[model samples]
Target: MNNSNKKRWFKKWWGILLIILCPYLLFLVILQSNLDKKKKIIFLALFGSFILFIFLITALEPSTEEKIAKEKKKQEQLKKLEQEKAATLEQETKINELENQKRKMNLEKEVKLKAETEKQIDNEIKQSSSEILLIVSNDDKLFRQDFKLMTNYLADNYSYDSILEAKKIAVNNINKSQYSIEKLKNIKCNLACNNLNEVKAVFIKLYILRIDMLKELIKFADASYGIENIATIPEEKIFRRKVIEYTEYQNKIISFFENIKAERETHE
Candidate 1:
């Protein structure tokens, strides 16, 4: 027969039947043969050993159900790993979003704080400017006129009041200047008005000093009244020196205030 047309022994129906009956046929033949007892026993042992070998092979080999179970377990593990990875990614995204929100809140807080600080500075500037102006205006109107009168008395001899009357007026001016000092002390100052109140205080003190000097001069004139005809008063020389000093300081204060006003306007 051609090889292509030939049937394999294991594939034929009779070959399969023969394979199934082989062990039984051998057992029957061993029993029927006129063999010695020892030989029969030996053949039976060999057949039992063959059967044991086949049983061990079938027991040790993996079944279809076990293989399927193992593959299913591997798939479950892969699915669990995928789920854990997705969960980790989601957690990272949430953390990033929270961090962004935190940064945004911090930025807004900084802006609000800056605005509040700027507003506070503006209020201080306005308050300081207004108070400083008020003080300067009051000084010019109230104290300056009295100061001029005292200076005139020191400069001229007879156009003004008598020595006794001038002395009384000088005392009055001193009291008024002292009062102005107290009033100026009450007005609080700010950062922009640094040393301003102190400057005004010094000016008032100088005013009082000049007035006191004038009083002394008037007293001297009164003491020498009718005893001798005084041509030039000695105290007038000292009083003129004080007047020059006062005028220079007054000019400095005026310039200082002008500069302050200009600076304040720039802020506006």
Candidate 2:
């Protein structure tokens, strides 16, 4: 405190003196009231002892200012604890919300990826379907027999040399056709599958018919090559069988193309 305040506090000695005497004065009043001498002495003794204890306790006890300071410190500590608890709960709530947001974002990403993959697969399927039809259309013209070219040598005559020459030319043509068929078989569908098990069912049917056409072509080419006597070798029968197989496979290809269109449209 400043010098003036310190002087004023020191001047309160009379107040201290009055507080010390107040308890004794109260005890004396109690002793003087109506009572037997023995009871009065016992009560006086107890009262004196209580007065002594009060003096000792007052001397040892903290000042009023100290009590106020301690109460303020305890209130600050309690407030700090409350603030810490609130922060912890808020932080936990934020963490839970962030985790929930992350899960939702992951779920959305997974769905988007699934949809994109399906779209890519559908595009591949449609392109593969179109390519397959185009390939089949090419084969129709590739295998169409040109009898005029084969029988061109007959204009010269029905002689052994002429017949042999025509047969040799026919064999060469058959060899070329076999090479072409091999090339055709080499064509493959490079398509992304959504469900291979389902797509495979359709492809398998197409593949079976293609295989049949390949087998017939092989047989026809071999029969033509084995022609010992053109009149009796029945090479024309082999050609006719090839034509029938080709026609059947062409029909299946057209049907398959239509089916693919229908299936895609249904999904749309």
Candidate 3:
């Protein structure tokens, strides 16, 4: 049957049922009236049962409007929660993407820096090798020239005993010499004048002569075989020993010259 007709029919029958049940319940109550306590109890039970039945029927048949309203409210709440969840997920995804980008950028920077460092090290090694080759080539010629000049000058002016005396004199003179550019200019002049000047020039020359000679001597010493007999002669022994001591002094002069050259190059 149609919904309206069914509702009307149920409403009419429900009222009739209540009326019929109520009279029977009232008769029970009246029969128990002589027992006052029983009468009260029976009336209370009937009232409670009637109310309970009415409530059950009303709950069983809710209006379509109310059911639809409840369902709509639940759907709206679910939609709001879903939107919030989606927004949260989107935010998390964005954060993850940003983090990934940052990591990639850092890795790229690190790789770039490492490449630059390796390039710098390679350049430094190339420069150092070139410098070593240049020094080796020039030093041999300079050393030989200086050695010949110093030995000749020493042999002409001083006896072996006199060379020792000159050394003492040089030690004293070193203290008097001022360590300045103007003083160095004066020393150059002074180095050409008297017996001391001759001795000083020879000493300075001898100092430069010893670098290659000392390196050779050290190599010979480190070799498995002993130094050659020709290299071990008394004269050769004295010359080599003298050059070894002189090389120490020459190294300081060489370092000074190098510093001056470097400064000039830098300014240029």
Candidate 4:
């Protein structure tokens, strides 16, 4: 054929073939139509048949297989992209769930820790109250002992001015009177005047002295007890010094009473 005739032939027929086959091939690819072939040779032969059909009907042009391959590759790439997107979404969801669970656990732990701490504090407060009550009771007993001893000394030496002076000092020092003071005063007046009315008045005064002595002694003892308790683990030297100080104070007070008792005995 002449080149012009061939060119015309190629242009008209090839253009027609492309118009007919392109849509059909694109539809097959779009629908993902699969043709079963048992062997590689069979697959190639099927592809060659489409090429031959196009060649016979029109002048040689681009084959349908290349377009189909490109479409298939594009579809595969899209499928891969969809799979990756789905996987990423799943991972993000799992991560968010894990984070929420971690936050919940941490919150629960914090709540539990707070509750435990409050319980410990409450127990400590109760323990401290109990200790204070015990210490107060001990102070009451000591006050009673001191009041009884001083009263007995006075009763035996009522004529002595020193005995009366001691009573005046005790009354001045005491701030309030309770049961012990009333008893001590009654005993004192009975020893002094031998009158029933005076004896009754003495009882009231003793009661007042008892209450006053208890109040003052508790205040002092509480302060000393707190200081000593906080220093429970103090150095041995510091402990010894505190002990010595307490002993010296006790000895001085005892010596003063002893001198009073001795003077009374000599006069008698």
Candidate 5:
């Protein structure tokens, strides 16, 4: 083929393949051609130079297999990194769940402890209230007995000595009730016990007031030589009022105990 025809043929896809893959066959064909010897030598030299240039470029680049292997290694590294991130995320999630569980358990424990403490305080208050009521009840009995005896004795008594004697005995018996007051006051009352303590203390104070009123009535009688109309006297009126107050306080203590008992039964 002419130079132009050869150039055109080399430009085709198969011609380029033949040049790169079958250069030896192309050389043998050139040597057998009817071309001039000098032209053949020049063409062979050029062809040899072109083959040499192709060899140098091929030697400098990596092979297809090595490129594939390197790409696969890079893909594997990316996959491993993703797996590690997923594992780390899973571990962090587990840690968060454990922390939430721990907090819930601690909160439940605190609630249980608080409820137990409150129940214990309520039980203590109940027991103490019962004891104080019994003490007051006993004191009330003693007061009633002395008051009854004094009233009966004074109904017919006409002398200062007997009236004064009755007053002394009544006053002495009333003073004995003061022991319950001291005992109640000495109790350790916390915020929970304030209501019960306050009511009981008021009841005792009213009882003491009644004692003072009785003493005043006796003093009036002693001054009048036990002949005055006791019903119309100011001291007698004051004494009656005190007795009414004492009775009201007694009712209040009773009601307080009843309410406490009702609450206990409901809880049970």
Candidate 6:
């Protein structure tokens, strides 16, 4: 009869009730001789109907324990789903970080590649120019060509139709090759080669070479400026002074080159 308990259609409760009730009713029949048979049958039918009703109610209701178990299973599934979502999010974050790092590295490499390419171009330019000047200085034909051009510009009142012979006469007392414009230009070019100390040496060589080249131009200007003869023109004095100054600079460069070369040879 308890709602919390379960029961089958026919089992121990029904059989026990029949066993005890039947005997009790028989006892009642035997005790009261005046009792009617129809009254006993009615009493028995009422008791059977009440027990059947209780059995049906007990059998049809759902169990509390099974419902609790189902709720627990549903909660566990939700918790597992939440954990899987968290793991997926974490994995995605890690992948994004890796991709960012790869992108950064690629960008750095691109910038570095561009910088190196520019540096290589500048180096090639200097190297090639150095080679050209060295060839111009060493080739006698090229040197003579520049010399003739410079001399032709020298419109001195007196004809230097044989300027080569006259030039040989003027420089006979000194080393002509060392003080020549071509040799000084070559020294300036040699600064680009792998033969000297870096910045300071290149600056010094270039400065001195400029003087060497400039003095020769000054000589042509002095000769061309006035129609007067060499004896009367004060320009002759200025030209000779510049020539001396240029000669001194040439000596300085030659000295540096010779000293450095010797030092390198000694160390080797």
Global Cα RMSD, each model: 8.7, 12.4, 15.4, 22.5, 7.0, 13.2
lDDT of 5 at 43: 93
Best by lDDT: 5
- Tens digit of per-residue lDDT, candidate 2, span 85-172: 9999999999999999999999999999999877877766665555444554454344344324435543453344554565555555
lDDT of 3 by residue, 184-265 (tens): 2244221213432443344345433443344433333333133344344354465557566666665656664555346435
lDDT of 1 at 77: 99
Positional deviation of 252 in candidate 5, in angstroms? 4.8
Clashes of 3: 0
TM-score-based ranking: 5, 1, 2, 3, 6, 4
In order, candidate lDDTs are: 0.66, 0.59, 0.51, 0.49, 0.71, 0.52
TM-score pick, better of 1 and 3: 1
Which pairs of residues collide in model 6?
none
Candidate 2: minimum summed lDDT over ten consecutive residues — where? 3-12
10 residues in a row with least lDDT, candidate 3: 176-185
lDDT of 6 by residue, 127-229 (tens): 5444433432353344445445544544443444433343443343123433443443444433234432242344345444444554544454446444535
Clashing pairs in 3: none
Query: Which runs of model 3 end up more than 4 angstroms from their true locations?
Result: 1-41, 52-64, 145-268
Model 1 TM-score (2 dp): 0.57
TM-score of each: 0.57, 0.50, 0.43, 0.36, 0.63, 0.36
Q: Tell me the number of clashing residue pairs for each predicted model.
A: 0, 0, 0, 15, 0, 0
Q: Which tens-of-lDDT digit does each residue in 28-101 have in candidate 5?
A: 66786668999999999998998899999999788999999999999999999999999999999999999999
Question: In model 5, where do residues sit more than 4 Å from their true spots?
Answer: 1-66, 157-162, 189-191, 198-202, 205-208, 218-233, 257-268
